[model samples]
Target: MDYDIAIVGGGPIGLAFARSLAGFGLKLAIIERQPLAALARPDYDGREIALSQRSVRILDDLGVRHLLPPGGVASLAAAHVLNGGAKRALVLDPARRRRELGKMVSNQDLRRALFEGVAGQDGLDWLVERDVEGIAFEPASAALSLNDGRTLRTPLVVAADGRLSQTRQAFGLGAEMNALGRSMLVVKVAHEHDHGQIATEWFDHGQTLALLPLQPRQSSFVLTLGDREIRELCALPPAALAAELERRSKRRWGSITLLSEPFRYPLVTTFAHRFVAPRAALIGDAAVGMHPVTAHGFNLGIQGQATLARQLAESARRGSDLGDLRPLRRYEQRHRLLCRPVFEATNHIVSLYTDERPHARALRGALLGLGARTRLPRTMIGTMLA
Candidate 1:
């Protein structure tokens, strides 16, 4: 085999996984379509990742945490979930002695940190500006054909390509993909009033709005609406767009001014029917693409990669076959147990909150009220956030 293992993505999750295998003396390959320079210093893509404590610990273990910019990390002290036209909100506060629910970091910053940690590592090949055109899996190894007419053989191949992973498709793995008919627009904004380091999610009549606290006077504004509506908002000039945002938010944070270019994404959630196939296994978005409603996408990706890395490292230490099904099955079962519940619950939440029927609205308000009055539910949510 040309390599012991081959990872088919170079995003944060893939990079972190590669870094985890460092010092194991395994010949690894990271095949990425993105250029090397972009991997080193990724541009901001207007998405902020809410990382869990477990995820932070994983990054720390990988030696990537310290590489993040100090100012780029924001504390999520509390979260408020509000229903349509309701003054009351279901508040999730930090547990006793805990200062924050989680840490919020820009996507680009995390990517850069992971890339920095993985680059120049021993016994690893960083193949940039390349695409995996085909894969031929054998009982003993897999042959990965590059777009440039080169084939690399590996005992195990990991698919972290993304939600729309072509590698997973090539492996004949089916996924349950739900394309929600809404789009999300994210922008950096400066507001007059303080956000109090609180993240607020509002489910109004026909839209969803979230304000994630970043700096003292700045926050990330996330608005979800119909595709045409989002396009219209994106088409507006800066001043007009800011005014529209201020109006839509009901001036909750007082006046708002746009501070950065807006970015929009169509909301889609996906889950593979299986996490592994033969000599190939899936990780990151390729395994489970989560809805951002609960802000678990990035965190779950980190957890999946870490879980797979641990299993693979153990296999290497035992001098076992790198493509052994034993370790791969364990990784799949554990990751599936960790992901399935969250993925289903998030989809349910999105369904319930986004339903605009009268009965649905009433039920939503009742659920929110019940959650606010119940300490157990709030505590559980807070614990989950922490």
Candidate 2:
């Protein structure tokens, strides 16, 4: 098989890339190791992605925004950060930043929406349950060998396969993986409080807990803790775990109960040393995997996909080689510039709040107080949503 671009990984990032290039007169194929039905399932477990205004705008442009299930996307009008056990809260109104601060949607729903959008468009092909065994790149085209003894060729190959990208390894791309000695326990809970479209985060000395408002009478709870602590919590029965969460959160929502099984993910920062190699380019987590503390991982992926599509489209308009090193370099440059600062900031914030030193605690409290008083910092955060 031949195509203008071969995208490895049928996740939201790959699907978004396909949708972005729908009308560009380019043939694109997405290869995935999982069946389409598996991705479309409503019960798939993953963190809910908080889409920024910029991300929503890009999705709207691709005409997939409405495909999100009814009530699947929750508008967050306000965000509150609490310190010292919710004794002090700093509230920031995201609505003041833009028409809508952002929207929270299940990862499965978002992926299904993108897949449907791409599947309905022309010049897009889906290859599921197919794994790439190896990649051989040349100036004219790149050849990808599948485990099933089939070979696919394309002028450009996008390595959106994820942080552990096999394509990246085939091309000898090096990356730095910083493993934070922490994991996140995420679960949905039924609550009596209205929550009023408010997203709340509570930062204690060693852990940070977040309650993200979902549709009527529900919210997603994300608890970050050390590995040992997580294991202990996981060993507890469901009711016990709910009790612990309620105590940790200081019963802010009156009382809490688990609505689903708890899911845990190790916290890590994956930094791909390069974003492009010869006839291939990287997008999404394949390029940069961020800490979840800032909720920038998926949003960054969307932005990277959009930036790559726009750069390639411009190259095509000028009759330039789409896989040319120059065009790919431009994409890498812009994406790195946009992602690096957020990655660093998130890491720094995590370290500051999770430290155990008394001095660090005092510093964290002072910083939070200062952030509350400063209009400039608040404005900058507001602009980030925009």
Candidate 3:
């Protein structure tokens, strides 16, 4: 085998997984199709990842947190969910007073941090601008054929590609994928009124909106609408769109001005039938792609990759087979337990809020009221958030 383990992705999750095994004396290779220059300097893609407290701790331990760009991270002090047109909201505040609920970091900054952490490792080989033409798994190892006519063998392989993972498809693993017709349009906008560092989730009849606080008067707006409605909204001129946002928001922010180009992301949720195949395993979005309504997608990815990495590292220390199904099964078990409930809850929330039926609305309103009165669930959320 050319390497003990080969990671088929150079994204943050994959890089973090590689970094997690840094102290272990194991041969590793990271296969990435992205150009090295791009990896070294990733572009700002308007994605502000709301990382849970646990995730922040993981990144800090991996030494990637300090590499993040200064002033690029924000604090989420509290979150409130509003159902339909109800004046009241299900409030979720931080566990402690005057402290943050979680940290919000940009995707580009995270990628830069991950690249810095993984680029200079001694026991790892960086395979750049390479495509996997084919993959075959065996009892002993997995053979990955690259587009450059190179066949690399590894005792273990991990697919950290993405939600629509090519490696997973090649491995013939099935996934439960839901392509929701709604499209989420995200953009940063400056407002006249201050947001007080509070995150707000508003579930309207035909749209679901979230306003994540940034600075005093700036926030990232995520508005979900039907596919056609989203295309029309995206097509609107900046001025028209700004007015539309302001009108839709009911001038709660006083007035809104577009700060960046709107980014439209189609809402799709996916979960792999299994997280492992023979000598291979899946991590991050490859294993479970989540709906963003719960704001646990990226956090779960970090946690999932961490779980797999921990198991692999322990196996390495014990001189056991890295390809053994025992540790892989353990990883899958732990990660699935973490993601399954959240996935189901997110789906339920989307359904309840998106449903326009009278009974559904009343039920959603009642649930929101119950959530507001409940302390245990909010406390659990606070515990989950960093």
Candidate 4:
């Protein structure tokens, strides 16, 4: 076999998985369509990732946390969730002696750090600037045919490709995908007032907005709207855009100025029916693409990849084949147990918050009130961050 395991996609989750497998004495390869330079120096795409404590510990173990750019990771001191135009908000704060709920980092920086951490790992090869044209699955091994006419045979193949993973489809795995007819516009803005390291999410009538604190006066302003509305908003000039944000936010953060280019993404969430098939396994977005509303996408991806790596390591220690179904099934069951609840709950939240019906508006407002008064909702969110 050309390698013991081959990973498709070199995104953060994929790279982190490879890095975690270092020193395991298993030959590995990371196949990415992007060139080496792109992975080495990723461009900011206006997306910030909320890192749970477990994710931070995993990155620390993989040696990618230290590679992050200075001042890039931000502390999420607190979070406030508001409903409609109501003044009452549900506040979530860290427990005693805990300085932060979690950390925030840009997706670009995390990817770059993972790429750097995986460099110089022994028995690992990078198959970059190439696409996997086909895969032939056999009982003993899986053979991947690249666009460059190179065939790689490995005992196991892990797919970390995006939600619409062609490899997952090729493996005959099915996924339940929800393509919400909404797009989220993300932009970094410099506000006149201090954010106090607090993040705010507002599920106002007809729209959803989140202000993620970064540094002191900077924050990531995320606005979700219909597809057409978002496109029109993106076409506005910088000054007009900032003004519109101020108006939408009711000048809560005082004045806002655009600090970076706006990035828009159509909302989509997916969950695979199975995370394993024959000698194949799916990780990252391939296994589950989460709605960014709960900010669990990459966090869950990191957890899933780490779980798979542990299973593989244990199997290897037992001198079992890397592609053994017994271990792959264990990874599948464990990851699914962790992913399904989050995926379902996030989708339900998006549904309730975006419905805009009179009943939904009333119910959500009541829920926010309940959350503010009760510890259940606050505790749930705190646990998610931890």
Model 1 residue 210 lDDT score:
96
Q: State each model's CA lDDT, in order.
A: 0.91, 0.84, 0.88, 0.91
Give lDDT tens digits, candidate 1, residues 1-386: 89999999998888988998999989999999999999998999999888877788888899999999999899888899999899998998777767788888999999999998988999999889999999998889999999989999999999988999999999899999988888999999999999998999999988999999998979999999999899989989999999999999999999999989999999888999999988989999999999897898888888888888899899999999989888898999999998999999898888999999999999999999998888876577666655
Per-residue lDDT tens digits for candidate 4, residues 133-167, read: 99999989999999999999999999999899988
Q: In candidate 3, how many Å is residue 57 off? A: 0.4
Distance from true position, residue 235, model 1, in Å? 1.4
Q: Compared to the true structure, candidate 3 yields what TM-score?
A: 0.97
Candidate 3 residue pairs that clash:
53-386
The ten-residue window of minimal lDDT in model 4 covers 377-386
lDDT of 4 at 142: 95
User: What ranges in model 1 sit over 4 Å off?
Assistant: 382-386
Cα lDDT over the full model 4: 0.91
lDDT by residue for model 3 (1-386), tens: 89999999988888889998898999999999998898899987777788888899999899889998768788888898988789998988877643877888778889999999987797999899998989988888889999999999998989989999999898888899999988988988899998888899999877888999876788888999998898899999999999999888778788899999988899889999999877889999999889888888889999988888899899999999999998999998998888898889889988889899999999999988998888975687876764
RMSD of 1: 1.1
Q: What is the TM-score of each candidate against the true structure?
A: 0.98, 0.95, 0.97, 0.98
Residue clash pairs of candidate 2: none
